[model samples]
Target: MQPINKMKIQFDSKSANEAFARVVVSAFASQLDPTLEELAELKTAVSEAVTNSIIHGYEQMEGIIYMECRLFPESIEVIVRDEGVGIEDIEKARTPTYTSKPELERSGMGFSVMESFMDTLEIQSKVGKGTAIIMTKKFSQQKDRSFSSER
Candidate 1:
């Protein structure tokens, strides 16, 4: 399947940019006419993915984070990639309340939150390389609209 529209951006892995990433992705997803709840969920997922990159991936140091968003008729796919220390155990990272840095008081719910908000979550990583988080969500409200028919 081909995407109707897609965007890619790379930014410094700074904590402030987390909000920027969310706004960019949310705006891109808005074209789908998703409900506010759906949009908020997407933003939240993006927040978690980006925050993870800034905190765990780069260890709060300077690095790069890549974010991509692809839009379809009634769904969106988002990919967040970071070139930092890759996760040692992807499975453990996905577990609820599993924080690699418990000292920081992280709830360790990043993956869990993303999974709950998006329909699917995929994680790929290589030690000393980086990690990529791919997520997808379908817009039920948009599916009901059938904009073509309305036109």
Candidate 2:
């Protein structure tokens, strides 16, 4: 389905940019009229996605991160991508408390947080290429209009 509103951004993959990505995404999601809790969750999810790109994808090396937010009638889709050393095992990476860099003492709950906050999450990656974390969230305050006409 085509999005009613969409926004995309590309920024340096610095740890500092994590907050920038979150605020950008959350601002885009505001058009959906989500509750405060929904907004907070979306921010947290965006933070995790961007951090994963910087921390795991680039391993803190210099890189670029791309983010896209698409708004539908009742939900929003967010995509965070990076071109860096990709994951060897997507399944293992999604597991709770799994950190590729255990020495960093990371909580390793990025994926878990994203999964819990968003309605759905999809990951795409290729070794030596990059990773994309695509997530969608449905706002409880907005009713689904896609199927209403059918009834």
Candidate 3:
């Protein structure tokens, strides 16, 4: 019920860093007693977010990707931020089958996959500035809790 312990990682534009982030974050969350299903979902969501930052945000340019992992006893928080070209419109970006780069064969499902995998997804961006995505998912419970319920 107290504040969660967290760690932040900064990596250069590299595909291997994305994979490492996914594995490390998933493993960190796994220590919280998360189920295998939950772990897989978290990994997928992290991958989508990191891949977006590396490919879309930076556009393969030389930029840094910032990832923060907050480990709570009952939940986890992962924030991926980039100072590359920010999203012009977050709403349009989240739309299914929406890809800015069709030539790259992007499925435009990054936001969708993140939404489906995580309990919550929020994106903040500004043109010529950057984009930051905050994703949070709590540990599974036997009973469903409504929005009005306590965390």
Best by lDDT: 1
Off by over 4 Å in 3: 141-151
Q: Which ranges of candidate 1 are over 4 A from the true structure?
A: 142-151
Better of 1 and 3 by TM-score: 1
Model 2: CA > 4 A from native: 142-151
Clashing pairs in 3: none
Task: Give one digit per residue, the lDDT tens place, for model 1 in 103-144.
Answer: 999999999999999999999999999999999999985355
Candidate 1 has which clashing residue pairs, if any? none
Error of 3 at 97 (Å): 0.8
- Lowest-sum lDDT 10-residue window in model 3: 142-151
Q: Which whole-number lDDT from 0 to 100 does residue 79 have in model 2?
A: 92
Measured over all alpha carbons after superposition, the RMSD of each candidate to the real structure, in angstroms, is 2.1, 4.7, 5.7
Each model's lDDT = 0.94, 0.90, 0.88
For candidate 1, what is the lDDT? Answer: 0.94
Q: TM-scores of all models? A: 0.94, 0.92, 0.90
